[model samples]
Target: MAPVAGRPRPGDPLDPDAAISVRGLVKRYGDFVAVDGLDLDIRRGEIFALLGPNGAGKTTTVEICEGYRSRDAGEVRVLGEDPADGARAWKARLGIVLQSGSGDSQLTVRELVTAQASYYADPRDVDEVLALVGLTEKAGLRGRTLSGGQRRRLDVALGIVGRPTLLFLDEPTTGFDPEARRQFWSLIRSLRDLGTTMLLTTHYLDEAEALADRVGVIARGKLVEVAVPSALGGRETAPATVTWTEDGARRTEATATPTAFVADLATRFDGEIPDLAVARPTLEDVYLQMIGDDR
Candidate 1:
């Protein structure tokens, strides 16, 4: 099958080609385990989405990988270095866009981006970064005056100004409207085209479907499964629901052989079947089922 748009085929993250790798990871909050024996690998240039419900260890795992939180056990390697021991040079190789951001209210977009660029030994052009995140027009706008979506773009601009090889996006579009969300997705796709490896955590299933080459579902501190979005959780092989309109009513049947079923329906009608649809389980369906079973 052709690869998903804006994403490449999945590869092993531990094969010396991975941007991020985690093995037998574990994290505990005293009596409770937030992450337990999880293993994951994100290839050098693919967008990987991590999904789970609240209290499912998603954030903890990400934090550990990003070197913000310490892991109780297991090994993690980001950009071939342990984040806990990563130096300024090592950090410059990674970009992070958190769910929320903090900035001086009076600083203009250009000023903020320029200041961020100063931290790295080598950084992308400030104006180019602004344009890349769709903030070129708002370069002179103060941080306090920008709308929510524009501010989010600025956050992204700051994240990428250092030309990071890998990016971590945590709930990147939480407050965006549909149109703004789509625009942000376009920006992300552009970054992926530039060969940026990304680890994304989001609750939006469609966003995951649209951007992720591979998705790993986490629950109760463990990774339940990891697969390409189209085939995740065995969705590609799951039974399809064949439906059609008949005598002013709708008819539906669940079947594994949707093609044969459709052929029979066509023979019955002796023409094009009315309102025919063959629907398979979506990524969201499999995700919910996996998390639910874990609980």
Candidate 2:
């Protein structure tokens, strides 16, 4: 089993190799606490997904890391520098793509990307970034003329033109269709392969399972757990639910050794079992349970 990560002790030293690290993170609004004593560490070159329901402090925490918001208390280090004190060089090492984008600009695709590329010290070639996001075909089209998925792709093109070492993506696939989402996932994986560290926040459980190397769930202003998608909440060791049709009705049982149980059932019937099915808790199931969502 993969090792699970938990909150670090208040005095624990910062991880030297971590792309982002937090200790005793806290945030508040008037009488409400949005984040409380949270600790997390995201390694370099890995895609880390932050998952939480609405009003769960996910955005507040991410904003603090991105240096867009001030924290009431805690320590945060991004790219080995405190975000609050980040300089131009430090800022250039990071890229941000917000949930909503300015894709309605009148500039053409290549024009916008080229303009964005000029902001960094060593940006990727304009045409290559466009091709990487599958936007080469729409290079000449104005942003307002592109479809929703195409516009999202354009957003990514702009985000990566700077060749940032660390990128933060917020709900990147919000307007994408299934096929488009899958294509975007491939682009993200390719970025990870090229040694770009990423921090992602999204409502899609399947997307997190597909792309994230590690996932951290936040509930009511605190981190609940951090683990690989398959092993979150001990799901890997949880019993499997086996179901089959028997005696003119359906029956079900949960077992840890599903393979042995199935073999025994096969012998009892002396043939293939009718309507046999095996299932386990899904990522969504565990996430919802973790957040205490009774609905």
Instruction: Output the number of the TM-score-best candidate.
Output: 2
Please, what is the whole-model Cα lDDT of each candidate in the order they appear? 0.86, 0.89
Per-residue lDDT of model 2, residues 42-111, tens digit only: 8888899999998889888988998888999989999999999978899889988877775478999999
Over 4 Å off, model 1? 1-15, 247-249
What are the runs in model 2 whose C-alpha is more than 4 Å off?
1-11, 293-295
Per-model clash counts, in order, read 0, 0
Q: After superposition, how far is residue 35 of candidate 2 from its true place, in Å?
A: 1.4
- Candidate 1 lDDT by residue in tens digits, 1-295: 2233222223323434578878788899999999988877788889999999988998888888777899898888889998889788889998988776656479999999999999998999998898888898999989999988888888888889999999999888988999999999999999999999999999999999999988888899888887889988889999999989999999999999999989878888967889999999988888889988666
Query: How good is model 2 by TM-score?
Result: 0.95
Write down the TM-score of every candidate: 0.92, 0.95
**How big is the positional error of residue 134 in model 2, measured in Å on the Cα after superposition?**
0.6
Q: Global CA lDDT of candidate 1, please? A: 0.86
Task: State the displacement of the C-alpha of residue 13, model 2, in Å, after optimal TM-score superposition.
Answer: 2.6
